[model samples]
Target: MLTQLSLPKLQIPFLCHGQFMVRVLVVSQAVAVVLAFAPGVYGDVWARLGFISVFVHWISIITTLCLCAARHKINQLKPISIISVVLCIFLTLTLIVSAVAFSLFSTLFNSINHEMSDFLAKNLMVAFIVALVAVQFLIVHAEKSEQLNAQTHAELNALQARIQPHFLFNTLNTVAELTHIDADAAEKSLLALSALFRAALDVGKLVPLQTELELAKQYLSLEQWRLGRRMNVNWQIPDALPAIQIPALTIQPLLENAIRYGIENSAEVGKLNIFSIESRNALTIVITNPYYQSIKSSGGNGIALDNIRQRLMLQYGSSASLTFGNSEGLYRVKLVIPKS
Candidate 1:
């Protein structure tokens, strides 16, 4: 009962703005058609449409301005709600004023000096109705947009929290063993592990290639210490490619997951390769690890990979892609980052 009562209400400002603008455009178009048929009907229908476009453009501009101003850091909902009501009132007044002016200009021209107050009043009423409908549409749109944004933010936070458990749980177990066997090696391992966590925590949705490389190296160092003679690592990062940016932790987590699953699960020795190349205005990172389906029955947990792919889509739209495949018993993951 309390959860239902206390649920935060969400509103989407973009959708509201969109619906309002679209209605305004439709109304303006109708008005232009009428005006073109009236006295002194300028060029062609296309010219009248272009002229009406300007007013529609202004409506969008003003609505955006209103939204930008709507944002506030107020804690209490009442004050913000009051402000939103006030903004709606202001928009209504603006519409009324615009309607009055248009009606007066369209009907009471000096060339005719005709008494058309009744016609002008009717047009004003129509305009007010149009504006009110637009505002209602705007409110509904805003609510949806706000809900979507909240969901996206929550998902991102969940993904970040999920990563810590998978890597840290395994690392801590390795550290526990290292501490008892070799004190000096364990100390170095702890430091490298700290760097790894720091890197994960510091990263964002997108990061520079140089930063990723540094973090990748730190991760490899920590894992090497943990695995000792059991793990072999190779990295091929060209100096020219260092400046290029990639999705944050895009390459490292996959590498870590590969090592953790590939070598830790296998009794036989395992090797990992990290390679990057810039070709055809695209950056590709390939991570390869030995795979034995008999020993490791399942595929990846998929959360981290899915997170990376989603982040790529959110940040780079359709320009970037990630692919996974197996060839001759070697598991490979590839990331393609487009320059264009």
Candidate 2:
């Protein structure tokens, strides 16, 4: 049921300024109509202006909606530019017919003359043109936004792909190291290694929180087997937080980094703490490991930390954060994911 939802579809948040501008234009037009055309309410320029303004606003909105809908349909065809041009011609014809009908209805049954009707028709035509311009501007703006998002996604996928090889190299080396000392352990490690690689290959760049955490557990199990008593793994995650989604292998790679750095640097066994915090709107995963001061001071390895940051940015843009620093004697990685 959850898989059917396709919840990862990307969308842009609506801007208040854009909505405000549309509202202002709509309100200004409505007010102008009330002032100008109100029968016997005002006997000045305000009345005439109001009459024309309201009419202009109404006509503009209708024409714009028509053009926008037609443009959207045309977009489903071949070239959008060609479709837009054709749609504009159709818009002109629609406006002409509407203006003629409005003028005939107003003049034949009322006090307005042909001269006034002609002026009204001209105003309607101008409104249609204004509406067309607005729709075109909106289309251009939407397309630019989509292109930028596409570029960001492409950069992120490239980053994810680059980070995969480093982990593969490490795992293969571990498998090689364990082969001779304990034949049975090495065979089990190989099986776990195969499962880990298969999961990594089959899973998408992003997955449900439950799926990622499951993968993380499998990964940790394999590492623990390889590291033997030299690695200590501790997990503290509530059951409620499993519903929140995250990038696949996001936590695992960070854990791998911690393990690699901690175990390699420590003369004795090193402890790793993997925990999650579920707040109202965010689910944060913290991976902490004890490291020697020398390893902590050496700083980034250009693999796990940077890779995770790039993936989060690609998936959540500015909405998610990945941070690393030393607190007390432990080096820690904290990934803050927005609650899905």
lDDT of each: 0.62, 0.63
lDDT of 1 by residue, 15-42 (tens): 2234555665666666656654677644
List the candidate 1 regions with Cα displacement exceeding 4 Å.
1-163, 176-184, 294-300
The lowest-lDDT stretch of 10 consecutive residues in candidate 1 is 7-16
Model 2, C-alpha of 142: deviation from truth (Å): 7.9
On the 0 to 100 scale, the lDDT of residue 94 in model 2 is: 46
For candidate 2, the TM-score is 0.54
